[model samples]
Target: MSEAEASHRAIARWTSRVIPAILAGVAGYGTYVVVDRICIKFLYQERNQPAAIIVILILYFLFLLLSLWSYIKTIWTINTDTGLVPLTRTPPSRASSKKQSRRKKEGDIESQPYAASAAPDSDPNSPGLERFYTKEVFICESDGRPKWCPDCCNWKPDRAHHSSELGRCVLKMDHYCPWVGGMVSETSFKFFCQFTFWCALYCAVALATSAYSLAEIIHEGRPMDGHIIAAVAISAFFGLFTFSMTLTSWRYIFLNVTNIDMLKKAWVYQLAIQVPRGTPSTDKYTTITYPLPEFSSPQSPAAGVNGHATGPTSPVPAQENVSSARDQMATKTFAVVRTEHEENPWDLGWRRNWEEVMGTNIMDWLFPIRKSPCARHDVVESEYAMGTLVNTIKERYGLDKLPREGSGGIEMRDVPRESRRSHRSQRS
Candidate 1:
């Protein structure tokens, strides 16, 4: 809005274009030196090694082609998951009465950005539990509310983080990479990885050939040229940079985590519990020594394994419930389940995690030839499967050990380490 701010915006837009051009110019110059100075002038004419020149040039062009294709695709890539989830069902007859009778209440159930309509007997204000874990999430607040993005005015999808640069919520959002010329979200992620990988290979080839050609000139007492020297230096730098990027990208891909998630260290299970109002004492909370059973594959969708629905859509499972209505009017609150271990629920083992991001085939891993399997099912089917830590906790305590489901009792709460230590000191 201010003059300085407007100028800054203009400068940013110009730099975005300039950076890509500079990169392209550097790569172009490297290509020229490799093809013209090294292959044609030195290898073909002076040394008269047509076969060697042919072989080197063939490899050079292949890597160059792959790098360029991936770069272009990544720049132009658009994600499919960017949009609002409009109200799917109309509000019922009591909507007017409720609107008139009830003011905006604190701790009101958070409406989901894509919450399906409530069933007839269900509280209209309460949206269904988020079943899918891959992208869409139902459990948001500790009290089982979906996360609402104030800026985006929608329920932020699972792992969807708002990018400050892009000013939008990006699903499985990664950092904004200048080399790729955009924020690497779910769509452009694969192409970005491929571009870095192919470009690394491209630089390696250029560096090797240019260094070899320079060696030949040195052996023959030929003077060095600036062009060949620049090629080697450029290739070496780019090679290191791209190689590092490739390693980081593939590592996260293999682990089934994103750069943002890794930065946040938000790999813990965001579990929930129910409690009544009026400051219920912590005494009502019970610490079960062990966790409940890992909800098996045949369980209700709401009681999904690692937030992924294991079975067909069914009504919320008949868990331990209170018979009286007074006990049922409980407020749900959030708890974080943490162990003295690092566990990523999203990790489906290294191989399966790789398949989730890059697809199954070797070609798919090496090149951006096809969209990944995760791309198709970003909505519901793809899973955020249960992990070892969760299973460990579940195995510790049987379901019978947990509190009655609707009793408004805190079933699980991970007290901070400091609190636990202080409590132990007092006891001592």
Candidate 2:
């Protein structure tokens, strides 16, 4: 490997392994300091409350155990699911090959394709489609199909991205957290969320207890202990930081979006609207651009579009838009286009989306004991699934409705009148 690659590997090892160890050591030291200085020195020895001190010590240890377990589990799950831990396999023999072929034949015989026109709204028996919605329908922009990661040497699953840090493709990767020293991925997301929650809770409790002890000392006209002051400062800082992180993580969980998704909005939009090869030129590829919500900053432009502002704007001519019949036809097809805000195809309503990641069980939603499956399992399936979120959106907006022969192309009726007025005002 090159010098740069070796350096990166060293950094990854330190971050993913050494940093976590260091954090654990720091936490242990902090616990010792708190128990010695505050709990024993102030609460028990001075106040003569041995029983209360024991109970408090027990609770602190319990929180520490939970936090440590969650952190370790999160890292392990991420590594396992992201293919960071390589599995050993023996060379396939003729017998194994024959068995695989036989299984493939049996599988093909049992499977049946759903009709393109069928949707969850129209079809009563389309639960499978809805279950596997995100994976089957979402297409990559590179070739207007599910993409193969050259580095991983495998078909990239829906929402999976190649992580340079981990040297693998991670499913639904939120981010590589330096604090945790690992990638927060689909498999580990729940545990990571729990870890943050626990961290915040533990810190808050410590801060509260330390503050109370300090306040009592001051009221009794005692000198402020340096150890107590240090404990308070550390607890306060970490408590606020962890609490803010927890809130941010929960916000993403509720939205069913990832930190990476938020950052790569333009890329996601580009992937969603990629037109398949051999699609008829007369078929208008109507891309609905949604206004960025008030919560999110409008700072990124749509793919292939040029504008100073982040809002959706007209498509600029690119090298890809050559003077081919298909390109010419696409231009003509959308000659009288009506721009509307595009909804996220992956958003299957907040409730369904949350359930998709966190599981349907309320207990499972609250706890991180059980692992939740990835959103889209059938990554190798065809372009579109019958009852998927994408299909549902298309059906609701009449996007799949055939264009009239004399009409320019697909007519979108959800165009906002306010947007048009704004356009007019800008022109004037």
Instruction: Give candidate 2's error at residue 211 in angstroms.
Output: 1.5
Which residue pairs collide, candidate 2? 289-341, 289-342, 290-341, 290-342
TM-score of each: 0.65, 0.62
Off by over 4 Å in 2: 50-55, 83-136, 148-150, 265-281, 286-342, 375-399, 402-428
Give residue 376's error in model 2 in angstroms.
Answer: 7.5
- Superposition error at 215 for model 2 (Å): 2.0
Model 2 gets an lDDT of 0.54
RMSD of 2: 17.5
Clashing pairs in 1: 130-138, 142-333, 142-334, 143-332, 290-397, 291-397, 292-394
TM-score (C-alpha) between model 1 and the true structure: 0.65
Superposed Cα deviation of residue 94, candidate 1 (Å): 34
Using TM-score, give the best candidate's number.
1
lDDT of 2 by residue, 265-323 (tens): 24333233312222232333433222212233323223212212222334446664334
RMSD values, in order shown: 14.9, 17.5
User: Taking the candidates one at a time, how many backbone clashes does each contain?
Assistant: 7, 4
